[model samples]
Target chain A: MKFTVQVNEGPYQHQAADSAYQFTKAVLEKGHEVFRVFFYHDGVNNATNLTTPPQDDRHVVNRWSELAKEHDLDLVVCVAAAQRRGIVDEGEAKRNSKDAENIADGFRISGLGQLIEAGIQSDRVVVFGD
Target chain B: MSEEMMDDEVVKKMAYINRRAPYGSIYALESLEVVLIGAAFDQDVSLIFADDGVFQLKKDQETAGIDMKNFSPTYRALEMYDVEKLYVSKESMTERGLSEDDLVVDVEIKTDAELADLLDDQDVIFSF
Candidate 1:
């Protein structure tokens, strides 16, 4: 089966992120294909690249990047939501003359169209949120 | 193979809003899991977070400080599970003295009014 999953919360302070990941992993482990993964709300901050956890902490950013690459997934971060929290991609970083590109790799910085498209394109639209 | 297979099924958009930190309790994570179960069957899904919910994305967080499990890392694995739409409120980040640099993953940020607009778009909303 194919699934479109949307995550609207982060992993740190929000358990929604972890729950969402587990659900996605379970679906794929069950041999399901994920059509798209859209990030929004506080979930948008999931794309930020400048996270350095404590030595003992779980490295969520690295994990997300790995999953995206391994699964050939489309990680779409809403551009409007991303920039509002300072999650800038290479283009936005350069455009704003910011010293950093906080957006993560293997993810597309895009609009809500991708989300709506996912809704229209997937067999199931599962949300892991709060 | 195609999304159209579920077109005949009713589609409703549900937004899950996370408005707290990563630790201190399970108020946010557990609540979200309950909803994912529903999304698995029927309904479209959207997740949103405002206010303190933005803190949930901070990178490299150790719940040891609060005697909790470090679950933030689990978020990165969400894509593999097929849950990928994450949102944070722009105003919340600003008020919390955080920037995208402070976060640990990929996300979308919106302002107060925009958040409201998104809530309007959803058929159901859950907040933590």
Candidate 2:
């Protein structure tokens, strides 16, 4: 089945992001397909492209990016949420004339419509937030 | 594309709203895990972050001072897991002197009216 998962909590605040990550892995292991991921609220931080964890850390950012790349998932960062938090892509950074860009790899910038669309298309739409 | 072309039938919608801060608590994280498990079962999930919940997404968070490993940096890693439908109330943001620029993620900053409309559309709503 096609699953659309939405996570609003960014990394490090709590284990919500990690749990969501594990759940996705399990879903794929069970032979399920993930249609897309819509990050909003604090969740958009999950797409920041630049992050370095210490040697003793879990490297959560890298892990999520790896999962997206491995599964070819559409990691979507909400456009309004991202721009406000200074999480921008190459194009957005240039357009906004922002010196800093934070959106992570394997993630794209999109609108809330993508999320609503996901809810309408996927057999299931799961959300992890707050 | 317009929603008109999408599936007309209303599917089961599940939401896990996280209303906690990033560094000073654990409830927000634990609740998210349960929601993900539920989502794995083919449930429709949506997340709403109101109040201080917006702080959970700031960049460069370190927990060394609190003698706890700062986990705020983990917010950006939700994509591999596909949990992306996140929402925040505009009123909440404004109440706390926050705007779209204060959060780490891109969220739907809707008015109470819009949230009410969205909530009404949900077949089921769960708050945490």
Best by DockQ: 2
lDDT of 2 by residue, B1-128 (tens): 33532545544665656677764665565445445444444446677877777666655566677887655544555554566777887888888888787666667787867877777777545444
> Positional deviation of A111 in candidate 2, in angstroms?
0.4
Candidate DockQ scores, in order: 0.04, 0.09
| lDDT tens digits by residue: candidate 1, A1-130 | 7788778787596887777777877887899999888887678777777878898988777677888898888888877667767888888888879997877778888876666556656666777765
Interface RMSD values, listed in order for every candidate: 9.1, 9.1
Q: In model 1, how large is the Cα lDDT of residue A72?
A: 89
Query: Residue B92 in model 2: shift from native, Å?
Result: 18
The segments of candidate 1 whose C-alpha lies over 4 angstroms from its true place after superposition are B1-128
Clashes of each: 45, 39
What is the lDDT, from 0 to 100, of the residue A54 in candidate 1? Answer: 93
State the lDDT at B3 in candidate 2. Answer: 56
Candidate 1 TM-score, true structure as reference: 0.53
